[model samples]
Target chain A: MAEKHINARGLQCPGPIVQIFKEAQNCAAGDILCVEVTDQGFKKDIAAWCKKTKNELLSLEEEGGVIKARIKKG
Target chain B: MSENKKTIIVFSGDLDKAMASFIIANGAAAMGNEVSMFFTFWGLNILRKPEKIRTRKSFMEAMFGWMMPRGAGKLGLSKMNFGGIGAIMMKSIMKQKKVNTIQELIESARALGVKMIACTMSMDVMGFKEEELIDGLEFAGVATYLGEADEANVNLFI
Candidate 1:
């Protein structure tokens, strides 16, 4: 499967999630989407989004106020 | 009636409230939920067109139309607006934070297939013509909103 990166860093609230959703629409099943965000709410939001969307949260990490996530499309 | 359906009644006209409605709608829609927003009362102002649309109306209707802010750009915040300066400051902060503006949020919600319904009763009371509001909106009444809400698991009044 192919992997795509979404630079959602600096976006706030739903901005990062919406960007990931928009990008995910173009990806095939099993494709991985990597996203980075600076929004403090993203950690909880991303987990909830993955659960609701049935996507696999491969990895999630935070450093220096930037949170990164890898999601495998379901 | 799908389990993954949401309905929001946008009752207030404040910019902050409008943004909140759109943010939730967009978030739910991104998570693969169907979302519907009903605009009524002062919330109808959020859908108004920015440009002046010439339409014949009664004196009170004309006055109401003249007094209300036109479109998303003109809406003021619900609190600490400071005679509109707060809205300007908020917009600047959102820009700095790379947050989407209400205009962008509305566009994103539309693109995500979120249903936007404008209340006909409110339109009549407010003297707003169909052409006076932004495009891509469904004109309906409370019954329609109720019908949508009945099928939705989450119903919020903003």
Candidate 2:
């Protein structure tokens, strides 16, 4: 199953990060989280987090004015 | 032990940039990671009381001239020159769209245990008294900031 949430589209940089931090806490080992953001600064940032944490980024896409990211817990 | 912390050394008071620094530090802290913000020079202005803000705001404010003090208009990035009007308009739009104020965000960061440090040198230079700043700010020197920066998983200068 997939859990999707809208986060920090127009909020700001760390807004999305704050959402990711919270989600990472409740997530199971295999749970999927979709983060929708519009901050361009987060493109490299979220990728860096995935690489560092060993989590799997299932997908990253942009629709309209939002950056949608899907990540599966490691 | 928690994950390696992220340390940000902020030298500018530009609202947008400082807000970005605070957001990163607070985000990292909320994630069970340590976070520190080193405020230097113009960046220290954010910590000052509302009175000082008005004095600075008159000259530095880049957006909506009549907004409240301690508002986003006083931030370093949102200043009146170096692309002032556009940045101000964007900030006004962001505010209209429900972006949280910098002060509110700072409070959230503090609640999450993000460390806030103001530079002693900068304070001395600015001639700010302890009573002039908001409560609960930690003051220190470059060495202190550097020590934390050394152990940081991510170090940012904003």
Candidate 3:
């Protein structure tokens, strides 16, 4: 499976979420999506998204002023 | 529920209430929800032309009301009075946290296609001229809002 990358740093709340949805549309099963966001809003937002959409958050970690999250499309 | 495809209605225009509108609308829009912020009555004031809507009292309040950004932005907790000193406290916190202004959030929402509709009946009642509002705003009546609202699983009033 291939992993898609999204750099959403400096973008606020729904910005990352909107873009991620747009990006995920182009991906297929077994594909991985990694997003780099700045803070808590993304974590809250993405978590809820994953829950509702049935996607899986494979990994979430913080590094260098960025919050990294990965989701594997189920 | 379809992720990021919910609809929300914002019925308030107070500074604090507007903040709730901004946070909620943006929050929902972030979830990939096709958000529609049906701004009616006072809510339409946010899209008012920058120059036409001027503040009368509270210079500091006016400055924050005017300078910080208008409409959805004027709604921030910082710009609002959560309490006597709450506005001030929130402003400081926002400055420290680097959160986007309500205007910026609205702009971002538009960029993401978070359809924003201004209520026609409300505007008429309020005597707001078309030119006084921001560009790219979709104008519609109650029925229009309802058509979309009916399709949405999530609906809210603020």
Candidate 4:
């Protein structure tokens, strides 16, 4: 289970990613964060952010219209 | 590859253009890139305070301030301004689309540590007071902008 959950659905490009950046800061090392977004553009953006911030992207899944990303803080 | 460095010169005070600048800046900063934005000419209007603040200035300077948009919220559209109503419609549409507003984008850029610089020459020419602009800004000349742009991996003028 994710230690923190972020509901960023319906947000446009960059908004969802910004929210993830802010929330990820509060997560301790080894804590997992789950982000829910509606924009497909976030797929690439989240991957880049995770790599830049040194976080681990465990999984990214899409269901219906929602995209869920699970990231482990590093 | 080496770390990315992005620098932008904001020369337009239009709402859409300002929005674009912030969006790019925030994205670059989020990706661990060093981002710098230099506001000059009409672009300085984007940094003006929202409320009307009376500052002692020459008549010409006061007129310039009065005529320009107060802040990001008051900037007109570059094209199809439609007497300023177009800007209002655009703001509404952005809200409906769940896009970050220009003001929100500016805040995000600041939070992400994007360097905000005001062109000293432009400020003098436009008769803008230091107090009239937003806080957390570095004042410099064109040389300063060039210095940063020279080393930036991505340089843009908007």
Maximum-DockQ candidate: 1
Interface RMSD for each of the candidates: 1.1, 2.7, 2.8, 1.5
Instruction: Report the C-alpha lDDT of model 3 over A1-74, residue by residue, as the tens digit.
Output: 89889988877655677678778878998899999999667767788888866788888888887899999886
Evaluate all candidate structures by whole-model CA lDDT and list the values in order.
Answer: 0.94, 0.72, 0.71, 0.90
Model 3 chain A lowest lDDT segment of ten: A10-19
**Pairs clashing in candidate 4?**
none
In the range A1-74, model 2's lDDT, one tens digit per residue, is 55756566786766776768667877778888888888887787788777766678888888887888988878
Q: What tens digits encode model 3's per-residue C-alpha lDDT throughout B1-158?
A: 43345666666666566666766676676555678888887677677766655334455544434443344434434344654366556756766766666667777677767788989887666656566678898999889888887878878787
Which tens-of-lDDT digit does each residue in A1-74 have in candidate 4?
34899999998877887788778777788999989999989888888889888999999999998999999989
lDDT of 3 at B13: 67
Candidate 4 lDDT over B67-133, as tens digits, reads: 8899888999999889999988988888898889998899999998999999999999998888889
Q: What's the lDDT for candidate 3?
A: 0.71
* Candidate 2, position B112, lDDT: 78
Each candidate: chain B TM-score = 0.98, 0.77, 0.74, 0.96
RMSD (Cα, Å) for all candidates, in order, is: 1.1, 6.3, 5.9, 2.1
Error of 1 at B6 (Å): 0.4
**Model 1 spans with C-alpha error above 4 angstroms:** none
Model 2: residues >4 Å from true position, as ranges?
A: A1-8, A38-45, A61-67, B1-3, B26-33, B51-73, B76-90, B96-101
- What DockQ would you assign to candidate 2? 0.34
Residue B75, model 3: lDDT of 42
Worst 10-residue stretch by lDDT in candidate 1 chain A? A9-18
